[model samples]
Target: MSLFKKFPFKDKPSTAAITCIHILDEKKTILYVSHDADDGCWQFLCGKEHNIEDSRVVSLQQIYEIDKSIKKIANLEYGKCAYRKYKNSKWNVQ
Candidate 1:
């Protein structure tokens, strides 16, 4: 039997996971993560949406949650895929 068959997998609709990196004039970058809400998980400013524009909106929301003073420097789309797992811990980008 294939190893893939050993574990149950459910096919679900995929959503685009948007991430934004805020650049500062001081040559410092800010990556936002909700420590209180996310339980100390480190991640970039991110959200889920169906399209690039919608994803940008979601990313804006995420950014505001961290700091309203931070303006958007740029936006980039990483396409759509399942959440990457980190061993038995929290999810991470692959």
Candidate 2:
């Protein structure tokens, strides 16, 4: 059986997404997620700011590997954002 529930987002598993390189750091976790309304692009990020070079384009599935809790925000509305204080914290949509 799968460790996590299947993704609920409309985007495909191979869909391109923008994520901060910090997400690759062992000590860092994805605390924020955004679904742009204008272009319907997805962005996964840590709560803090990062340099332009810190950004990376990765498949949505790759991100799911980093933090499966993100599945909770898959249905988040366009133009909205979701954030949480910690990896295990409940996500708060904004």
Candidate 3:
């Protein structure tokens, strides 16, 4: 059984596990990775969860490669509805 199977949102077989982190700097600026440099859109560092571990190794590794000084301020997970909204409104903005 998958570790996330206990979570309410994990009931759907197609529900992908995503690890997201809010990276903050000393100046209080939030880090967002752009889909394309010229696209003028940005979002937090996130990765698909493929393992049972909670360390979010893949997402953390991507973030650390960008800036070692960036600290994790928050960790959040969105349900289907909220995630859809985010993907449509925030993430898809160009």
Candidate 4:
């Protein structure tokens, strides 16, 4: 028997998971959010919609619980950042 018969995924993923990012200001106000599917290459706050079997809320709540009260800014926030995502299925794709 072929292992393909026992596994759901074939050689590659059949769907692509989509996510959005929202950035907040000093007053916890959302300044920018992802508007399109290919809106990358910017100082963005990341967020993802999880599929948990619970409440009827489709879109997962994103609360950036960070202690932004400290006024700590010398020259920059960080050094390098790599933008990547995990493997998962799409929203409405089988």
Best by TM-score: 2
Model 2 alpha-carbon drift over 4 Å, by segment? 1-5
Q: Estimate the TM-score for candidate 4.
A: 0.16
State the C-alpha lDDT per candidate: 0.29, 0.86, 0.30, 0.24
Q: Per-residue CA lDDT of candidate 2, range 1-94, in tens? A: 5533466567888889999878876448889899999998999998887899988999998888777788888998999999999989999999
Candidate number with greatest lDDT: 2
Name the better of 2 and 4 by TM-score. 2
Q: What does the lDDT read for residue 7 in candidate 1? A: 21
Query: What count of clashes does model 2 give?
Result: 0
User: lDDT score, residue 21, model 3?
Assistant: 33
lDDT of 3 by residue, 1-94 (tens): 7634422321232322223433322222222333223432223343333233422223333443444332222122221111213222332222
Q: Count clashes in each candidate, considering only residues at least 3 apart in sequence or on different chains.
A: 0, 0, 0, 0
Residue lDDT tens for model 1, 1-94: 9633332212111222234432222222333333222322223342322243322223333433344332221122233122322212333322
Point out where model 4 deviates above 4 Å: 1-26, 39-60, 64-94
Q: What 10-residue stretch in candidate 2 is worst by lDDT? A: 1-10
Stretches > 4 Å off in candidate 3 = 1-30, 33-59, 79-94
Error of 2 at 89 (Å): 0.7
Candidate 4 deviates by what RMSD? 18.4
Sorted by TM-score (best first), the order is: 2, 3, 1, 4
Which residue pairs overlap in candidate 4's backbone?
none
- Output candidate 3 Cα RMSD: 13.5
